[model samples]
Target: MESPPADTAPQTPALTYRAPTEEDHARVLAVLDRWWDGLGGDDGARQRAGLLPRLFFQHFTDTSVVVERDGHLVAFLIGFLSQSRPEEAYIHFVGVDPALHGHGLGGELYRRFFDTVRAHGRTIVRAITSETNTGSRAFHARMGFTEAEQSFPGYDGPGTTRVTFVRELEP
Candidate 1:
């Protein structure tokens, strides 16, 4: 098949980033569904909703960020400032559309989150992922987070061990 003329080809859509609102809950969940569709069998399916609850998104609307191109939710970072550690912020969940993986979207999301939190007077950012999630561990390292303390046994529950990572933001 012949390719379309240069001017006739569609232009890549520009991604728009903004703070997520309560209205975006459905779209965000749908994006998560797509991103985690086949990963963890029955256990994964059951735990997905609880992992990033709708109520958390509704409550922490300001700190969260979502990126979209055209009208779809392409990536998201759901996070909030820590009440106990006033200088720290935590990333509760973050996901990028599988189609956009390896294109630096994840780093962009983390950068945006860092900027947002820093603007709010947060000096440190923290996040956690499963011990088995090597991909996430590497990504966090690339984003400037180092393992915080030691891996926690059953941090998420009875059987889930999690690796916590922390990044100190510039004031």
Candidate 2:
């Protein structure tokens, strides 16, 4: 039997998850606009990219995560224990390669973040998304997060309103 041609050969995905480092700041930022392109068009994507700042990588590396497949970034989650809320952790941002959505990568990243925060005594995890982002809302619901009764206006800016989601971790 002849082996399949290289072009037609099956390729197994090799994914690795690790805490993000300061060096990843630029790389992640570079992809944010593209990663979130679907959420908004070119201009909107650029605006969304501004949501994540270099400070996250600099200050929250210990609590953040990045996933790579065959050495290429496929997903990431930035989270941290809240300084003002001892029992709470906040998920600042999350992104999965658009090509690889719905493959459990996002959930895996969330689970890892939850475990990290849980180990640090955090009992609640919170996240927020634009109310128009139905995909995020559904994903959060499926992840066992409860939504707040109403969206918070100006949560991000003057005209921005966001839906908050919270999940209670088991002790």
Candidate 3:
């Protein structure tokens, strides 16, 4: 079997971002699983999946986003526009394939999500992560989010303190 020349081989499409859809649930979960798997064991990965419930994609599809390359899920951000605060959008979960870390895929997903919510008149963006998650804290900081004035402790569950971050969007 002869291989095609490098230049003649099929070229993967550039990373693309899009709103989530009902049909993307399984692949999204698989990506999450792969992401969590890199951090630890299966148990932790399963727990992480819970953070990305189907309802987010099914109902808040517009605010949520999925990034793909050659039709493979590479990253995603699950968020929604706030009903109580029409000017706000809340990002509940975000994940990037570990192998692609340092490549800025995570940042791209966030920027896309920001542009989307901002287009809908949302002027504020919020997200939360455990206080222990320094990686997340640093990433949020780099993305221009600041610690909320009144960050709540144990926001996730018992003994699970959280750091709340917010970003003010420009019109």
Point to the candidate with the largest lDDT. Answer: 2
Give the alpha carbon lDDT tens digit for every residue of 57-123 in model 2: 8899899999888889889999999999999999989999999999898888898898999999999
TM-score of each: 0.89, 0.89, 0.83
Instruction: Report the error of model 2 at residue 119, Å.
Output: 0.6
- Candidate 3 off by > 4 Å: 1-12, 37-46, 149-151
**138: Cα error in model 3, Å:** 0.8
Question: In model 1, where do residues sit more than 4 Å from their true spots?
Answer: 1-6
lDDT (10s digit) by residue, model 3, range 1-171: 999999999886898888889888888877765575554355457557777777876898877888888888888888888999999999999888787887888888788888988998999999988666678889999999998833577576665567999999878
Instruction: State each model's CA lDDT, in order.
Output: 0.85, 0.87, 0.81
Candidate 1 C-alpha lDDT tens digits along 1-110:
99999999989999998888878887876666568754566676566666877787678978888898998889888999999999999998998988999999999888
Cα error of candidate 3 at position 117, Å: 1.4
| Clashes in predicted model 1 | 0
Q: How many Å off is the CA of 139 in candidate 1?
A: 0.3
Model 2 CA deviation exceeding 4 Å by range: 1-9
- Candidate 2 local lDDT, residue 17: 86
